[model samples]
Target: MFGKTPAKEFRFLRHIAFPLRIFLLLLLISLLLMAALGQYLSASFEDYLTNHVRDMAMHQAKIIASNDSLVEAVKNRDSQRLSEIVGKMATGSDFDYVVIGDRNSIRLYHPNPQQIGRPMQWTKPGALEKGESYFITGKGSIGLAMRAKTPIFDEQGKVIGVVSLGYLVSKIDSWRLDFLLPLVGVFVLILVILLLLSWFFAAHIRRQMLGMEPQQIAQVVRQQEALFGSVFEGLIAVDPDGVITAINRNARKMLGLSSPGRQWLAKPIAEVVHPASFFTEHIEQERRDVLCTFNGLNVIANRGVIWSGDELLGAIISFRSKDEISALNAQLTQVKQYVDSLRALRHEHLNWMSTLSGLLQMKEYDQVLAMVKGESQAQQDLIDFLRGFFDDRQVAGLLFGKWQRARELGLILNITPGSQLRHLPEGLDSTEFAAVVGNLLDNAFEACLNYPESDKSIELWLSDEGNEVIIEVADSGCGVPEALREVIFDQGVSTKTDAPGEHGIGLYLIASYVERCGGIITIEDNEPSGSLFTVFIPKVKIIYGSSSNDSDC
Candidate 1:
């Protein structure tokens, strides 16, 4: 193993970690700045050189044209005299060439003597023919040059010839180099400083990362993937710009996405999660537990800020389905209520048993028989009434629980004899139906407590006829106030004093569930006394109903 390469060793040198990447990023930015600066410096130098060279050339040429010797030579129409004066002037000046051309554009003098007496060739169009002083840059007999041309006029004001002073483009560059050399030195020095900083940062970052090998970093990435994948709750991580950087399978499931790599990653958070408000805020403890209907799932989210040392990275959101929590709570509450109801029934039965035992122990057999028969008939009537709806245990248990609660309060619960409910109603499952029935019965029972024992009674009528299920609950207590009747079904509108997490949600739940399944609920006054609540549910399609195969409570 010592002879072999370490598995975590970097195979290539370009393994830039986060800090190193930052350093490279800085390097790239500095390089771009240098390039832009170089371009600007080069352009400015060329412009300055062009103007300085042109002005100097024009001044020298104008001085030569004003000389008496050049004027006398031109007046005599003497090419030989013109050549001698132009040759001497060119030698004395730093200009590349001082040439004299006749008005017919015949070159009388030039730096290249072989070009003399030839038609003067200027690279630009209309060169020297416009008879005006100007500067132009182009290739001539002496190669590319920036030349100043001025037309020489006779005393009669007629143009006789032209004089030109030319400076090589390369010569202009020599002057340009004066300023550019210092700029280039500064550029190189800055680049060296940048490189030193980059190297220093690279070393610092390497130490911080403990010089982890490529394989080790890859292993860490895999570990992260496994960690996120193994989580039960949804996990999503976003960048500072609100783009999803990482999302787990559970997140995909919660978000109703296609798969892990199907553009979900790196997509903007707004487009991935609906309503955009779910993960927009910097969610901490006080702001955590965001409840939103995102991606068609009711999720309760807890968002935490992600940071790298002192820098803020983004946010990590963990969420669970609200349906899961609700289901668990519902189960626990149902079990507890059922147990309480059964306990109340057992206490009542124990009292009955005590009375029957006392009667049997005495020497009163006929009175005992009459008492037993009366009790048997009442219990049988209650059983028969409940058996009508026993096809669904949820419905049976709900009504049975209500019956026991009424008895504990010493209130009469009357089920109309004309009522017939065969099974769970259409469009609502047993649990849904039970919840609706239970909440109504609880409200009725609470209302009945407002009256004296003699007047304490609740009337429940259930009938399934003509493709509709009708439920009516009439309480013999104070009727609903006329002013509050309109908003009675709204959430948090309970008539009772609210305790923590225990009040004002039942009616809201029932109304929402009714609306979901397309049903109607109404409130009316019961004859002679309290309030009558009637619910009409149409039988169309029952999708959430409990079947015979379902477990019994």
Candidate 2:
């Protein structure tokens, strides 16, 4: 029942999630910045309050320090005078309480008339000994307050008594409320403005998205489908239940289906195309970009498991034809088998010839001569042709295989030997190296025989550089057109049209193999009027062997 449901859901989420997520992330960052700034400003304001109270205490101490008359009055326990002086000082200043303490640790004068004659039992012992200022915070008659002590001095600057000042801390709370309340209100206003901006952005994005109509959106989707459908690759989608929910034009054609809605679920997709088909598991497991083969067609299939968070949806699979890859593999396999057979034949034939030579050398010539005149004489040229066909032992058998194929195509072959050359590279794999040479020679012969000429000849030349082996093949037939020369090595581009079921992937395979074997190939215009293809294979270092010996056939 889930028909193309997950794809649409994924598309919807992709469009809507992007903008909303961005807004939330920005909002989070803004909130963190505002919180940090608020905490810092609050701490600075509290410190400012504490310092102001301390400054008032120091100012009171200095006033007493400058007045010798006030110190003399405090020393004489002049309560009326001290009280009057302290009351006047507290009048204009921010202090709410004041006290004068003498050297006997007794309160000589206090702003409160009732405590004037009382002992200051709360005075600390180290207050005078340490000669350091002290600050205290407590709840007083006037709510919360901060108190501090400062020593007063006589004419000689001796600490005779202390002037103590107390200021209402609650006043700091009132001051902070006066300034901070308005500031926080303004910040809240700014926060509202930012929230409005965020809302406007979200709305603007929504409005832009709403500009496109449903039909216009559908048109865009259809255009995408048409574009992807026209390509050579195939696209398929399967549901979690293993049902084929969608198949593109190429995919349908590739599967050779006539009807619509290919029901592949519960039916084992192998029934529709075959289980051995590549890309089936990608649909089952929801994995992508897997290389697979279908029937004889090589294809690269990409799998994407459709998932919504932890929820598993169906899978979408897309595939492109890899006929070139399959063709290359097949060609290499054929070359391997062909070369193996030739090598076996060479060993067998050498044994037979050696026996014949021994009999003739022993002067048992009558039997040997008769045998030579029989089948040996007729097959001598063919045997000699194959023996000298491939000079490089590692690749000789492969060349022999291509020779027969060339002759059958009515193309004349010419082979010339090189002087003893450097050994082939040690790292080159024997079978792969042989395949490269054989494939190139085969392609050259095919190109030469492309012309409808009664007479055609292909010439081969071999030589050696200091550390490189060179091969040149030239044909006396129609050469490749200059315009198509650059594209000849590309897969599926070929000049041959007569061969059935051939997709022109041969030269691509040849070039791929040549490069893999550490060699280079170049096709150029021949001297008279033909194509000359040259190959250079680097010579590998030899451990215990001499350079390759050459022979021409």
Candidate 3:
């Protein structure tokens, strides 16, 4: 029987191989067991048959011999008469011989006619001399048989003759062939059942093992452990009791632990919790990322409650080092800002190309040249003006691109002349400034769409005179109301009812960039009737240089 056959208890059979191997094993065992059982049963049946036949033959012979006529015939040496009686009695049965003789143990009748009137050792000597009726096995001219001898008596009650009958042991053996066939059939059935059970259970075990052997599963487990340890983001878990339950290697490394993750096991996380109130505040705020200082290093972390069934089992925390995340975020923000700055410009470029194509079809070569020349000068003038404020070409490109798109949006976009942003410390590539400037410009352009084209204008002023890059973007559009100013830069706040998700990210990006750069941004009213977003980025001394990748375009 398979071990643990109860449902829901799964056991992988390590010894069971492929299906063919299981079949062969079951076949071999079944054959061996059936052969053993068959031998035992056959031997037992042979003994039983011998006893049964001997007892039946003895009983029948006694019934024939006790007759008065049988005694008289034997006493007269009446061979023919005795033969008639014996042959008549033996009819319609499997008896091999019926012999009648005086107590001298001589044969009177046998299937072999020549044995008549000859002496027979029908049974052992004691059966005849003592005139005792008994059974025994004998061998004579006939091969071997189980013979029964019964005594006959006249009215004086003295033995006058012995009647003997036998069934050949070989005949009994032949009859057992009928039993052997069905026995073999049953054994074959058992063998087949064993084979089927083997196949089914073997395949089931293989599936339970996830189509993998134990050694392969062990290898996978080890690989998974290594993967979890090598992951870059940190992970931590605490129980409902605030005990540290699970912490990965990355979590320990990110938290600047001198020991490994195990050293903190089962200990209260409160002892080393960053920002003492982080866990409480996170749970209260419904699980959001928080900035905290861990062991003197800044970290961004999130936490959640772990649950099992309906029970709150614990909390889980994931955290990582701030420097790497901040750097990655900056790169992503810069890319997004570049895309946003170009998106509007790209939209209007299609119109410009269409106009130029129409002009070319008309064969107005002079007009075409004049138009192209004016466009090139305008582009050059914007670039020259931005470079005059900040020598970095990346910043200059952003300002030029955003202004051109702002103009297309029908906003009178201009830069304040001689603003001291021209004296920005030599080292600023202005990626942060670019993010802040581009997103705000995009936001300002969108604000103006709510107003008529005549009321729209964006004036940007920059100065670096006070150890800061002071920037202001003034849009003559709907001014920020007092209530809205508090959360104007929250990621999903939008004044436009056009569509969701399309209009909110730009201002949020500007706010995030300003915060990470240790700069300040404020939204206030412009002079007449619009909004002013001002950014004051504290000056940081930085050196700038050109690289081989730098291009004039």
Candidate 4:
């Protein structure tokens, strides 16, 4: 009947708080177990009492049968003598009655005087004649009882009569009840204790779960999964033991792991990320914008700890590819360079306009025309030269802006003749190319600033010829010291003494880009006192229709 109830009837349980649900379920289970145990123990106790009573009755009957007086009394069929002996033995005993019977099954002695002369009721057929001693349960003169019968023998060892001792079934049942009451009390006490324990246990579990139900927790997990998957940055979460607890799709992809995140779950973070000290070291401290390599991919990573009150739970690391960061930096540098170039051009134009205005006011028409023609032709020629050789507009614009910037710094800038770069090498983009050329040129300009205006000069050479793009930049300035030359490309190494942190990263960044492209760069002392930096990047054959590009580099 309970099974036939509709499932919807119990659906309200889902709405209940987690602790109450757990307590109720535990209580129900405890009650069921206690009921089953109570039933079994009660039945067992009753059976034990019944067996004990039956055994007592049989023992008493045997003792009565062995008595020489009772045997002689039965042999003579003396009811008075049988009663006298049985009464003495029955005093201070547990049995309900003791009866003595003759060979004809006539009662010689009974607990009741009226039963003494009556034929014994419920006697087994031929039991007295066959001299059988046994126990039986049956309705007798008194009531239903467990009776043990023992045969009596004469001096010749022949069956004379029987002695029957009985205990009432109702009395045995009463004894069972007397024992069961205490047992029931113990069971009730145990059930009450268990219910209290269950309530505390359930409350503890609820607190551990942040007081949320199973359904609520499930919903939270789903939301977290969606959020993690949708994020652009790669994310990994590890437990306090350094085991991976969660990894997002972007994390797996960034780590170059093709297997699903579930396959990597519970694995040690060290196994997934090499040199995992970034995560393991100083775990309690939050780290941001840390440059580290994960599975051979350089990434800008940040790590933060997960906490529960005062306890440390674990840590989460979010990272993105360093190449992406470099790209963004490159774009921003290009924009700043353009802005500076425009500012310098504006200042230079104002000076030229001031000169032109002065000449026009003096009415020196010939000098004005000559100055205008010369300035326009010079600018036009440089623009045409850059457009003709450098096909990429970004690289061409970078060169033009640096040339203008060098002029504004009162330094002569020369682009070596026959320099040609038709197309950038494979794996190199225009923005990165611009960054490389711009940094080199900026360094040269800074170096030249140390010399007098008349003596300051910077020269740039670019050529994509015979399977390699070669670039050389030479500047007349205080050259790199012999001691610092080898470590010039290392981060935090620079000729400029001011700005300890800000001035050293440019060369390091250039070296990084160069190494990633499988290129070579070298620094040499230019004749007549200056530094010359040369770079060589090999070119690869391109197949236009292929999905994957093949590069020897």
State each model's CA lDDT, in order.
Answer: 0.77, 0.65, 0.72, 0.85
Per-residue lDDT for 1-553 in model 4, tens only? Answer: 7775776788788788889988999999999999999999988887788778878888888888999988878878888898789879978998888888887778888778887778887788988888888889998888998999988888898998888888988888788878988998999999999999998999899889998878889999999999999999999998888889999999999887876789999999899889888878878889999889998888999999999999998999999997676656655765788899989988999999999999999999999999999999999999999999999998888888888888998888899999989989877888777778888888888887865532688889999998988999999887778998889887668899777755666677777667666787899987787899998877763333443322332
TM-score of 3: 0.46
How do the candidates rank by TM-score, highest first? 4, 1, 3, 2
Compute the lDDT of residue 137 as modeled in candidate 2: 77
Model 2: lDDT to the true structure: 0.65
Model 2 ranges off by over 4 Å: 1-29, 140-143, 207-553
Give per-residue CA lDDT, model 2, range 169-237, as digits (tens).
777688888878887887778777777787778667656555564456689879977875787677776
The ten-residue window of minimal lDDT in model 3 covers 544-553
**Residues 1-553, candidate 1, lDDT per residue (tens digit)?**
7645754474443555666666778799889999998999899878877788889999998888777788778777687888788777777579977788777778777767788788876723454466678778889888899888887777766667778788998887777788889989999999989988988987887776767855688999899999999999998888777888899998887777887444788789888888767566643223477777777778788888876677777888889987666544544565676677889889988998888898889967898889889978987877777886556766777777778878998887888777767755555777778777777887888788865532888999987777878899999878789887888777557677546356555676677667655678999988788899998877764334655322222
In model 1, the Cα lDDT at residue 227 comes to 96
lDDT (Cα, tens digit) per residue for candidate 3, span 1-553: 5654753353444455545455666677877888899899888887877677877898888888877666778788887887787767767866787777777777765567788778877456776657688777867577788788888887787777788777887887787887778888888898788878878877877766657866788999788668767777787777666777777887776666757667898887778665546654444234657777776667787877766557677777777776566555645865776676588787767777887999999998899899889987987887777776676677778777778667766677888887645544333346756666776776777678776643777888877787788888888887788987888777667677689645556666666655544567888888777788998776764223545322221
- Which scores greater on lDDT, model 1 or model 2? 1
TM-score comparison, 1 vs 4, better candidate? 4
Clashing pairs in 4: none
Point to the candidate with the largest lDDT: 4
Model 2: colliding residue pairs:
270-274, 270-275, 288-303, 289-302, 289-303, 424-540, 425-540
